[model samples]
Target chain A: MSIKGTDYYTIDELMAVCMARTIKNGDTIFNGVAVPLPFTAIMLAFKTHAPESIFWSGLLAGLNPDPPFLPPTSGDSVMLHRANPILHLHQIFDLAMRGELDRIFFSGAQIDKYGNLNNTLIGTLDNIKIKLPGGAGSSHIGCFAKNYTIWSIRHDAKVSSKGQRVFTFVESVDFVTTVGRRTSTRNRDELGLMGGGPDCVVTNLCTFDFDPLTDVMRLKTLHPGVTVEEVLENTGFEPVLSDTIVETPPPTKEEIALIREIDPMNTRKVGFSRSALEKRYDF
Target chain B: MGIHSSKDKVCSLSKAVSRIEDGSIIAVGGNLSAREPMAIIREMIRQGKCNMHSIGGAHGVDIDLLCAGGVLRRVQNSYVGFEADFGLAPNYRRMVQQKKVIPKDTDCVAVLMQLRASVYGLPFMPMKLVTGTNILDLHPEYIVMTCPYTGEKLSLLPAVKPDWAIIHAHKSDPKGNIKLHPPYFADLLAIEASQNSIVSVEEIVSEEEMDKIGATVPYYEVTAVVELPFGAHPTSCYPDYTYDRKHLAEYVKLANRGEDVFRKEYLEKYVFGVKSHDEYLELVGGHDALEELTKWNQGTEKWCELLGRNL
Candidate 1:
């Protein structure tokens, strides 16, 4: 499944890049509460390339649920496997530490250059308005996986434009799912690229990845029918752009089929972006 | 008393299966695949266990074998596997295709909520989660339940209260007070929902040690606890044992491939020949009698293989 040209990508398409580019076959991936990264990894692992990827989720089973892949949390029942989870959620730390995992799909309310993720405490701890989902297992596993793929659908002017994200009510969250940098911590070597941090951000409009050196997360590509300027206008953070910036690849018929056709339990609805999101394509 | 004699032990897995009559609600613990007591589950299928309503936990070999073999008539909660290789359980898909098993879909909280309510003795748990989305809406039976107190628009979710609760344990006393660390709560709740609970334990402690142990333990909750060493080898219970990957990988291949292999390999290899839990342990080891797992490898190697492929 290959995307073709210079265009903005859909959330699903960008999610594919997050799955494929960040993770390869057999990589043990840790998924946060609600992420498409592990979903993409598992689907691609099953259908296309990686046939033996290790998946970890919040669900106690640590196995992927059957079909059409609608994961509510990284550990939703969908990820459980009656036959094999290698280990369940209880064994996540053991496996990750042993270098058994290669990738992780996480959500960070705030992220920095070093790939440190903050999924909780957006504002001050004492007086909190919007209390996001408490960190299920994101804190420890986020830095442990080989590739950390971060995603959030609500990247618009309100959350993104500010130095600190304000929730539906937050003053500022200090971390994010993936920022473009590496940390000095020697504990996490499984994650490839030393730090291809945040590998990709799957938004309503496009998919994003950052430069290896500059530590700047730039708009990697736009979804079909979306312009570079359109992505920037909607983007909350200043992104690194190349003059010949490529357009986001289009979703393949097969990729489309994998998503549209055998969607697990018909859970894959046309997921909506944030209220602030302005996508170029209807999908 | 000795922790485990390794002799005169009854076949706990088979014993557990014997209690589960057809169509009875069975609550099986172990997350997704890990910590699941496959030995007992396989015995049920090999014995041609059928028409049973399987409840609780995530997808793992037990659900796979049952669904693939047509033993399961209905499936509640999540399963098949989280993702990656073999994506989902083939047998479950086939069951869905043949329209044999009913799929009860739910979110993590929903599944937890259902189980949580079941154990709590609440008639039903109220959820703010919008039901119009996905599998949550698929099974109105599981998603909605009437609040016994309110008598209002409470969605009636079935009490996961099972007829028998079968679980794999690391260590427990003969009296059935168990000690487990992180993964303890899920199993503890399972016991609360079921009428009678069976525990296949790794070590059966004396009253002294068992009394000294303090964890999630309720004497009233347990019915039977068998001391079966290496019982949860491949599946961890923490502070007690680590995952045995090789054994689990073998199960995964069979489960993903469907029931034929499961019947041949797992049922034949582990279940049929063993007369009891001690007999099964003897099957893994020999006359020397006792065997201890030092480190698990099959899983790490396979994980390496998976990591390489993902990279």
Candidate 2:
């Protein structure tokens, strides 16, 4: 596989920029804890394309944080320093229920082929081997927010595999912590859920969108240097491939600089450092 | 009617927390890392309150320490862990994983709605947030109701009026009226939704000052009021001080290492060892940290300047 901008940018920066462009102007985004990538991406988008965007900072109940330095975690109290009209966590959730929020960032340890997320347990409820953190607000945010997006840092055979915990993209999720495209409108109506299911799934290697008809996750774009064959090999479940798969746009210098500005502490970039990447995949 | 004397409501932390009986549902106030009634929580542990049901809006050290101290039998809240780099709430995680305490998972909205239902004297609060989520199935208590007017279906969270509610605030009057600086998470609702409410504040002000600050929770609703400075220590008392990151990090590390170690050393050293909040404060770096933290309590102008918001 051939790649571009190796010297200029890292894969994580490219992914952040790619995700950042999806944020439309004036969109209100709700981000949860441990959200370095989405936090930086939203900040980058706000600084560039979407200046009017409001970040519902759940960490400190902050609104539109204009912090001097990005805190390491979304839960950091420093996020409240520059916030205006500081909000309550419930107030942020109230915005979601009121259809005021445009998008929410959600993730799970396991994602099924149909975009269903499982974060409750890796094994049976009675007996659990690996108990992932329960859905903090993703369960509601996934259905209330106009749309939600899921991103993954470790995209490997085990993470993207088809079995239980052994393979993440299972035939059926252990638990549907977050509603996704798999639940049709009729089903959602029965459950009294509004809003569309997950619209996008961004990862280190590729980006996926729901199929128009089937609502299954389909390949939308691949990061530079990655291939369809590699994605297939890594995924546990079969994914629909686009006929003309486009390369994910590399982060421009300006966007990169803005991301750096938002994250002067280098929290997001540190995860994508060469040594970190090498340790992750043993490359 | 005009405000009356609030002398009877004032009490010590021990007296405030004594209202909490064993096996009672106790609602706590605070966001993830802000305004948690740590002094009250510590007192509860000191008093040997065990097997109490814990419910709150967003809980962190308060609930985690209670779980670690073997005080909580079950925890019902949206989330219970320390956020971001602080990682999981160790004792909460260990207990839940070990099934020592039942974990009743709910969202932040659902928890508030439940409290709202109680506050409004309603059986349930209609919400759209929990719809189509696994919580409905996991907890069958959440019912789906149809809006009589619009005929639209919505999720109904049952009213959760806990037996006792404990909260921390910046200031309060003897009448139990509390004043919060800003980002008053769900403290008011929590206090209102409980059978009895105990409030710990940094200072006791005159009723005029309480009214000036807009005391949200009226005196009639308060069961007890205690003046305890730095009531929210490990977690923040927003506008007063940010969370003690190093202390919280140490807790997460010790709690994660093993429950035995947590129970033996961490618990012994920080909680059981120190007889009071002042002792705990002194042990954790004393008046120097408090003096430094006092700068944050003044106002947001300095906070904004530190953040470089103008630029």
Candidate 3:
């Protein structure tokens, strides 16, 4: 359980630390609903290096809330505790539309190599297989926020009843709920998207950044025990590998303490599976 | 639009909901699990309103109950499932998978833009985003046109003038003037944009008290108001009460059991089984349950406990 260091941490903690590292010191960050990982990461960033960063609690519509504890649902009014200058839903979207938002985080059911997200449904409109919660503001935020990051708790592929490998990272998403780096044939610039598509995708297993030239997902870092081979096996399409893939930096003791303090109920573990939750790492 | 200057617009929940007809496009206020018009939604189900089109921002049990009750023909909201608290809304997912309710999935900005267009008395509003996403494909009604001022292509979202805007608030007057707490979500916009609006509040204060509170929704926009305390039960009405997590947990459990069981166990037991909101309240542990939800104001520890979070 030890990875090159003495401090023990879980995958969720590492994910939160990695995500927090992406945030800038004064970025006006926002996160969508049901995202405890990002919510924790944002709070971690605020408490640590990004103290000046403006944290807008999505759905709750609170600004820089000093919540006592992380609620299970992001929409919980507890997020408004000590929050200043509460903004309405329209005002939040208006800020994004006016291109004032600095950074936002989103999670999806399906993500393609090009970073297109699908939270709408699994199948076509006519014949649906599974109906997921529709994308709340992903489509607009992905297009308007200055920058956005995609995070997910699920990274591994599943074996369907028919024995097909069902990949969370697919070659093409069934529906594009959020436009990422590019579509199948056109780039975001050509399509007149306002914001930078997707900066990076942080998952349970590894971290990915878009290839600068092609906009395809590129493997940037792997978690403590994950390997390139495992990522390739789980992904439906091949990802551009960096010249040097490094291990994701383990969560510092301070970061771990802050995360625990923010989420004492361990609400962040709700997104992980039972086995994944049991995984531990010695930093 | 005609002005609603009536001195007294107060009515019973049943009488207010009777104005909503089948196949009407409805805009529901409140975001996610907070401040939703739950009592009004229950009344609508009791009245057997069907084939309605629902539009909103983020939502959970409010729309799910409608779908479970077989009340919607089209769902145009941005998001619906119970966020992290539970998971995918069982009844809504089943209904969409079965093609019983057509999913007209929309984005939050697009919805706001369309509603703004309606409020501005315009035919459509143009936007630069949502062009490359499948939302444009899902909504064929959006028109992609080349902007005359600049050569950039823009998507024009048509105005969404709903037949009714249903909302729940903390306080209102008999004349229908209302006051809402912070984080208003799209309630005010929805009220002004819709052709008509009906509100349910925790208390009906005097017109003088409404003036002192400063009305968020003016009397001219609201068609009717009902004093239905705990109207947003199962959903939080901050400063009044938090979401009924234990009750919502039971609802999610029953909803996951399948549509037939939900209809019988949940719909028949809590919704249809009760003749009025008072009866429904009595069934749900009466005053004790409601008092516990309001205990968030007691302290941070009690608030965390209300949210099922232990310090």
Candidate topping DockQ: 3
Better of 2 and 3 by DockQ: 3
lDDT of 2 by residue, A113-220 (tens): 767787666666676555555677777778888888877765666533445435556566777778777554434445556777778888878999877767778898
What is the C-alpha lDDT profile of model 3 across A1-283, one tens digit per residue?
Answer: 1223436788888889989988999998877678888888999999889999988888767899988788877788888888888987777788887788888888789999989999999989788999998999898788888888888887889999999888889999999999989999999888888888788999999999989999999999999889899989988899999998999877787788788888877778886888887887875
Model 2 residue A235 lDDT score? 78
| CA error at residue A270 for candidate 3, angstroms | 1.0
What would the per-residue lDDT of candidate 2 be over residues B1-311, giving only the tens digit for each residue? 11324566889877778878999888888766677888898889888999888776556788889998889998877677665456567788778889888877766667778888888889888887455556666679887777899898777788988888888888888777777776666776777788888889899998888777787668877788899888888777756776666677778888888988998878889879997788988988888876555565444444433322221
lDDT of 1 by residue, B51-156 (tens): 8886664455557666765578977644444333233455665565456766553433445556667777787766422221223234557544445686433334
lDDT of 2 at B29: 80
Model 2 misplaced stretches (Cα beyond 4 Å): A1-7, A59-61, A73-77, A158-168, A183-192, A269-283, B1-6, B129-131, B211-214, B294-311
Q: Which runs in model 3 stand beyond 4 Å of their true positions?
A: A1-7, B309-311
Candidate 1 chain B, which ten residues in sequence have the lowest lDDT sum?
Answer: B302-311
- Model 1 bad stretches (over 4 Å): A1-283, B1-16, B142-158, B254-262, B277-293, B296-311
Per-candidate TM equals 0.52, 0.88, 0.97
Say which prediction, candidate 2 or candidate 3, comes out ahead on lDDT: 3
Least accurate 10 contiguous residues by lDDT in model 3 chain A: A1-10
Candidate 1 lDDT (Cα, 0 to 1): 0.52
